[model samples]
Target chain A: MKKLLNDPADLVAESLRGVERAHPELRVDHEHRIVYRADAPVSGKVGLLSGGGSGHEPAHAGFVGPGMLDAVCAGEVFTSPVPDQMAEATKNIDGGAGVLHLVWNYTGDVMNFDMAAELAGAETDTEVAAVVINDDVAVEDSLFTAGRRGTGAAVPVEKITGAAAEQGRSLSELADLARRVNDNTRSMGMALTSCTVPAKGTPTFDLPEDEIEIGIGIHGEPGRRRVPLAPAREIAEMLMEPLLADLDFTGGDGVLVFVNSMGATPMLELHLMYAEIAAILDNAGVVPVRSLVGPYVTSLDMAGCSVTLTRFDDELLRLWDAPVAALGLRWGM
Target chain B: MKKLLNDPADLVAESLRGVERAHPELRVDHEHRIVYRADAPVSGKVGLLSGGGSGHEPAHAGFVGPGMLDAVCAGEVFTSPVPDQMAEATKNIDGGAGVLHLVWNYTGDVMNFDMAAELAGAETDTEVAAVVINDDVAVEDSLFTAGRRGTGAAVPVEKITGAAAEQGRSLSELADLARRVNDNTRSMGMALTSCTVPAKGTPTFDLPEDEIEIGIGIHGEPGRRRVPLAPAREIAEMLMEPLLADLDFTGGDGVLVFVNSMGATPMLELHLMYAEIAAILDNAGVVPVRSLVGPYVTSLDMAGCSVTLTRFDDELLRLWDAPVAALGLRWGM
Candidate 1:
């Protein structure tokens, strides 16, 4: 409950106010809780819209900029945004090329984005297509998801697909590319501690001091199991086993290895974990052509880390390397 | 401690190994524990060397890259790096134009870096100038410092001076510019809970559940006082009042407002806190020309944040805006 917030109800709105001020390149629709690039609707460029709960920050809202998302509809912490917010954002960011919805594979998010796409299509002449990402290999079904929970892969998916969109790709092409990125990407998460929602003012679940939850979902969903705390080396194995099994990441153009912090995990530990994961990859003959290590997508204050691997082709690699100016992920610009 | 580490003794080295693996742009010397730009000794550019204890990550080591730092010496967790490491880094990065040692104001760090500068001076033909940063306005003298603790201002000092160095500023000129940047910057941190060092396996200090330590140091040193936890608005006032009182951030080319998380504070909370801080700045007529909100400087897993305001002139502003590709801070490149 020791959070830097005024009221739980005002968290998302107030934070958006700060985002608006901190990044002048972004314009926040405070009323609808939509964050859009200041120069959104870039003529013939397809609009890229993605969103989910607010707690997983730098995900939906922070990714809004020139090379990434055109707009993002932010919901309350750990809750899906209403369809109205998404529909409004879609209409606003849509250019002549059309709009693409990057929906993370959560039941609530998928349903809402679907409804939003329908609403946008009915209300405006905007062509909308949705690509649902389910890259988390941690669980087949979880508390908030029917299939695999989309976790860290959203970062690479958004980056690669957004880069393609910036190149004036058609909406269908962008959707296909997003799906291809998701198909090649796999993620697994484990938590050292549960995060406390500001509204609840308590940890979502109780984890013993000496235990950790493996294969955990972003919103404290029950994972594969709890186990006694182990070293980071073992933890990396537990995470990598499922990821490598779920996806063939050995060949092609190698892989983009991402070691993400689930909020409270420091960069030092993330780097350490990356070394462990890299060592494992080396043993498995998996070459990591590119690597990202940091807290790009995160749960609120959960002290944990996640591993994501995307087996990339030359095209996906090129798109990943393209310039991106989003607050969440920025490089090559 | 619930840290994702194998052995506390090997934490720094293991993390550095991961750093080396993750960022191919930077080269890490495992023996000396120095992280240097892959292209160190950049012909004639003055070498920018900064280092401190570990734990306050993305500080010295993460800043090693183009338009930032030439090299960084890393110490053990919350422990000062030895003179040998600093001396070795100095010799390697010196490009005949000379080397500048950026020392945070902790006693151990300043003494060690001063010794390293002397060692480099006596051992090699490399000219070295030192700039000691003591930007924390929390106290006149605290636990590990004589004047002010170099808290969050190392980022701006390194950035501005690093940019100047990249522009071919001489060692002495870079030293002067770094000192100027440090003088104009002021920072104050607060902690809601104490952080646990991996070796220590316990909280650094005892902080009750309902209270927070204002003006807290990054290393969990005693702050001004412990007060009952207040709303983010009041907390912002508590942090800003002292910063504003110590210096007039109202005029000039405005200020560079940086709100840094101490580690565990989530981006959602950080953004909300930024809103509170921005409103206070607006009321005080402190026009923030630039703002960086995130966990750039951190204290392991402590749950809190710090605010830094660097009163900028045109030159400093230009330097701050320069492209930096460091892993810790990257933009406009």
Candidate 2:
């Protein structure tokens, strides 16, 4: 595999070093493996934290800042972080208010974040809570996940909850808001190609030149179906049909739509897909209030995309528009 | 040929539709094919405009906003825009303070923008000035360019010049700043694979599985050499050595290092590469005062990266830090 790395075993740490040097506004605790906002631990404000496998970049780490995540604990590529990393991160971000963990729904991630929360509860006097994201509509189960796998919606959940937390919400309130946001979001993805795991040193799956895989997971797990490659309009229909059917999207509810690149898909294709998606939503009488089209959440160098729809109202729209200062998504700051 | 578009002919227009819908803060003039900041044509501030072929998402179009380009004119993919588009954009953005055209040093771009300026000069009272960017050091001359091809330095030039324009700098002052930025900046790029132009329905160039092309242009033009694939550190050296040799970079000058993914390169690998770059800079007693690593300027779905270093001073640093609101790079607002 042609990848820009040295000693595959040291990918995560080395990347963190680069991440540390890139953003002075960010404080990278190399020893503890925590990426925190430079001005973190705001007293009396809820602390927001998220962590998952490292391949889905700009997710946990790139989203670390004032109005999104206070700190992010990173694991190895496609691997879960140890409990100590999360525990230390929780302790540091925990001010007098509390800490909240936004864990993506994976067996290892769920278990490890749970262990870290328990350790933080036993070791520190800070209150802790978590909202697990399981928004993927592609499958009810996956290879490494118990239920539906969390996908693109994790980005919006982090942004919305962080905004609420910035407004001085309590621990329980933040948890409830997180759960609400997760419940209202749904995502579906497809892959034209598979990404190679660095350790594997080869592509995870081989795709025929003329065929495409639908409902594929972020990590190359099997999806709902594989079909003949088609135009972008058909692909959008295939992905969005299930999402629209699964969610109770109300007319004039003011929706937020995200067309995310899995990895290698360019913005040209994503925007083309978004144009089709916008037409689909318009035909359904749903007004798209906000639209984000790019690689906010991605698999490593995989050529595909995921579609996410979040039913928006006054509160969610406000939170979505609130100032967020993160590397991945920043506006109004 | 695996791109997400209904018809290859409609790629540019459809993407613009999505672009218009995605950012309500910016206005899309579909007729003339220009992206304008919603509150453009500030009375006393000099107007900034840049444009080129499509496909390069977020380059000219994504750079349009406050403290950046007041307007951007977009052409078809890899094809120069007609003079009418740029002429119309010039007339609209000129608010008594004149307009600055930042053209990349491509034959089509220079020829067409020159025509547009002449047209605007004959028809209206708006004064037009331009500073062409030609910082790619891969070769003194290349495939489609007269001297050198403009690549990553286009990003910093727009940013620095935009900041100066926002400060009410005269048209000539902005032109001088742009020249200074272009003269001090040097860039070199390499590609692991080739990208397919939509209209062509095939890869632009052939790259073998084990061999890579160094010093590639954004349009997939041939580079200086094709070498056997190497590790990220060695590749970093290959890229940085040429850049260092091309310019007189100093220790106390305060550097702005931009490691840009051509397209399709993941952030993980980019960060990993950045680690190597940071170490190389440190060993040379140089500190990167600012760093931007991602797909800011891209060739459509090409798997490669480019490195750009801008020897920075207090003026450039202040301009870089200036707040600009655009979709691609937005912060400090």
Q: Which model scores highest in lDDT?
A: 1
The interface RMSD for candidate 1 is: 0.8
Q: After the best TM-score superposition of candidate 1, give how far the Cα of residue A230 lies from its true spot, in angstroms.
A: 0.6
When superposed on Cα atoms, how far off is each prediction in RMSD?
A: 0.8, 1.4
Supply candidate 1's per-residue lDDT for A139.
81
Lowest-lDDT window of 10 residues in candidate 1 chain A?
A: A57-66
Score candidate 1 by lDDT: 0.92
State which candidate has the highest DockQ: 1
**Which candidate number maximizes TM-score?**
1
Q: State which docking tier applies to candidate 2.
A: medium
- Cα lDDT tens digits, model 1, A1-333, are 899999889999999999998999999999999999999989999999999999987777778887889999999999999999999999999888999999998999999999998999999989999998898887888899999999888898988988998888998899999999999999999999999998999999999999999999999999998999999999999999988888778779999999988999999899999999999999999998899988888999999999999998999999999999988788877
Q: How much is the lDDT of residue A82 in candidate 1?
A: 97
**What interface RMSD does every candidate have?**
0.8, 1.1
Task: List runs of model 1 lying over 4 Å from the truth.
Answer: none
DockQ list for all candidates: 0.84, 0.74
